[model samples]
Target: MNSKKILGSILLSLAACIWGGMFVVVKIIVEEIHPIQLVFLRYLVAIVFLILFSIIKKEKWHWNTKDFRLIVWIGIIGNAVSIVAQETGTWLSSAQTGSVITSATPTFMVIFAWLILKEKLTRVKIISVVMATIGVMMIVGIHLTGKHVLEGVLSLVGAAFTWALMSVLVKKVKTYSSLQITIMSTCVAIICLLPFSLNNTTALLKINFFEPKIIFCLLYLGAISTALAFVMWNQGLTMVEASSSGLFFLLQPVIGTLLGWLLLNEDISIGFILGTLLILGSVWVSVKFAD
Candidate 1:
């Protein structure tokens, strides 16, 4: 690969690592805070920090009407809606179920690209999707139970669709600087979540800033996960093909599942391991053979 591509890949890999740890952070924070309130605060902190960075860098905050609309759409689908759906799913379902089900993003990406980006639905793509779907089913097949399964499935479906839309939108907006686009979308997310944050003022204010968990989550969310990871992700999206970017995301579930087991002492089963392999294998096929 060229130097730019290699750099983008490394940055994206780093972003994925941070994101893998983020689930653990989110689970911890939600132990005390409501999902809505937690997400609201996370984005609120992210917005403040990003704005500060923008000011320090003397980055232009201005955008034309068209760019503003795209940024708003990105913020809505990628940040606001996707987070709500994922968190709601996590709240309702076991972490295993939520994690496995949400791995269905590539399926939605195929559909969305066909509709929006006019991307091809090749035989390899179809087979890859099937393999990934089957893999996820194998991984969480045991934990799929009760009405929570339905809730988890619904939340995951929403997450898949919304995130897929956001990816396509970002791909379309690749002309802009990744940093500018990241800041713009984060600003929009803050605006979208402002009312919720305002309503939860008492809880937010009462939150002890000195708590190690809270402090860690806030910094992790604001600086590493949201700002830096997104900058890397946008850069990757700009430099790489959409299909390739989509393929790299398959790393998320593998890394997340292993990390969950290690950090949270979550159980690992034969099914999960098998499913993970299948998913990874399918993604490999997609990346290697889907051309």
Candidate 2:
């Protein structure tokens, strides 16, 4: 059990760190390709690599009817719906607002795990989530006032809720391997986003894929962020209780802020350090002390 938790926590933290730095990659190239189009393309690249990976590992691509639907549920809500909603929310509101609000995703995950999976809401879990969330708020600097705050906030909350629900659902599906679930759901996401990506076909042609930088960024998104990270996250979910799984997500802002400071020359204020400590401390407390 201890070994399992250690391995799961490592995988989960790695996923968070990859995603945390993903913003830097997206920031560099999102202007050339639209968000929906970029999402489609990244997953397209991801699916190919994932398929190759499955083949290499000899991962069985089989699922029963009921489990298939649940896998599809994960893909639609998690990858397709939640991502589009988050894109819309970020568009309609400030990035700062999106960061602050979407950080609530883990909190919602805690709630959903309790409601859907009947996982215990222990005092340690509650306290960890509270401390981590406050750390996020501090790092993001909660400024919710904006032109489309109401609509944006709603979309963001929906994204968080669905994502949380999807995380729990991953644990619910018992038969599929993490690789199997990731591959199947990614296929679903591609189908859902296909029409939207089609609309951006003209824009897609404008991109110079030959440019080393563009190629690198797209590959990073596809291979590192989507393929590797999703597999890690889903596999981690299978090992840990759903309630504890979300605590690892709190590592994102810490990693993101550190990267910003290191790569982007962004200033790290005193609050950033304190918040990082709190968030990291909470994750440690949860992993080390949880029964």
Task: Provide the lDDT at 50 for model 2.
Answer: 96
lDDT of 1 by residue, 59-174 (tens): 75555777678878999889888977877776666556656766667777777777877878898888877887787677655466667668767986798678777877887773
Residues 1-291 of candidate 2 have per-residue lDDT tens digits of: 499998999999999788777655665566677778888888999999999999999976664999999989999999888876765665565444555566787899889898988888899988888988888867767556768778878987887788788999999888889999999999999999999899867898998999998899889989998999999999998887788788787777776666666775655556887887788888887877778
Compared with the true structure, model 1 gives a TM-score of 0.87
Per-model lDDT: 0.73, 0.81
Find the 10 residues in a row with the least total lDDT in model 1: 240-249
**Runs with alpha carbons beyond 4 Å of true place in candidate 2:** 88-98, 143-155, 262-267
Instruction: Please report the TM-score between candidate 2 and the true structure.
Output: 0.91
TM-score versus the correct structure, for each prediction: 0.87, 0.91
Q: Model 2, residue 102: what's the lDDT?
A: 69
Candidate 2 C-alpha error for residue 196, in Å: 1.1
